[model samples]
Target: MTIKRVGILGAGKVGIVLAGLALKAGYEVRISGSGSVDKIDLTISTLVPGAIASENAEVVANSDIIILAIPLSRYKNIDPTLLKGKLVIDAMNYWWETDGIREEVLDPTLTSSEQVQNYFKDSTIVKTFNHMGYHNLQEEALPKGDPKRKALFVTGDNHAAVDEVTKFVDSMGFDQVVHYKLTDGIMTEPGSPLFGASLKYQELKQIIDNFDHTDFGRKISSTLN
Candidate 1:
């Protein structure tokens, strides 16, 4: 399925950057923020020219793909029913300091994307675009044919949804898009070698194949804390 209209759930750095990239990739883009759309219009204009800014419900209803770019802590405030039948991309990371929580709420049981999928039960959720820094996301993407093209990892239970997101990622100048199983998301966790680190597709696959749960446990404990 082709993704034409893309919606972003926040007006923060991630949201703005994604919106700009989506627009650059020839998709109609819309964005919503907690504050008035007017307040963020200047930022949106400066970042993504011709992007539509509106209320959350309007943005969610009008787009084929919706991106949740807000903090994981604020997820509770969103109503999943609003995103029913839509492709939702989870781009959030658990920030304990910002959320004022000592431990990750989804730790020891589910990865952040899985937890987000559970929370947004009605939406087809895909875990992606969370591993890279905002700056890297905007500046590092290279076209598909480029020798040094960057890669992004995506995980989801739905094959169609994964395919759609893969196309979207590729259109944004990602050289390679690795579509892994939902369980593989744990390997791309915030502190893993796959996260925030630039690596080739084969190298990333090797890292995932040889991943050790005990080593992951230590990384999770150290990074999440």
Candidate 2:
């Protein structure tokens, strides 16, 4: 599938930087915040000059792919009807400090992306971009084959969708080193040892290799099984 235009929800740091990357990758990027377009227009102009600041509905209406960068607490509020059949990137993590203690979002049986998938049942959901801190993500992007370049983990049940997002992640100047089904994405979630790690391919791969031995990994494994 050809993905050209990208729509990003949440005009925060992650959203702005992602929009900038998409712009650098030659994709037309549009972004929306939690409020009115007028509220986010100036920030969008200053931080991501080329991205259009519009309402959430407009972003979904005008773009080929939708990136959900909004707070995990607000996921239920995202209108699923407008995104029916859309390819959606779920990039939000449920940080208790930031999103409060959301019991449903913390359901041990599913990753946050899976909860998002359940809500947006008709949409195709791929998970990535949530494990790294926005600050590390900003400084780590490098050209392909660069030694310092970081690796991103992408997860989805659909192989074609995983391959499609792998290209998009590469366009954002990162390598796609690990991928699995969406349910198996617990390895890249908030409690995973890999989260917030800005490591090169070998280092990250090493961690992925030993993840099943980690306490969090075992916890997830037992819960999901």
Best by lDDT: 2
Q: What is the lDDT of residue 89 in candidate 2?
A: 93
State the lDDT at 172 in candidate 1: 84
Each prediction's whole-model lDDT (CA)? 0.79, 0.83
lDDT of 2 by residue, 93-138 (tens): 8777777856755565666777889999999999988878888778
Model 2, runs deviating above 4 Å: 212-225
CA lDDT for candidate 2: 0.83
lDDT of model 1 at position 154: 78
Error of 2 at 188 (Å): 1.9
lDDT per residue (tens digit) for residues 5-77 in model 1:
9999988988988988888888999998878889888888887888998889999888989999997888878
Q: List the residue pairs that clash in candidate 2.
A: none
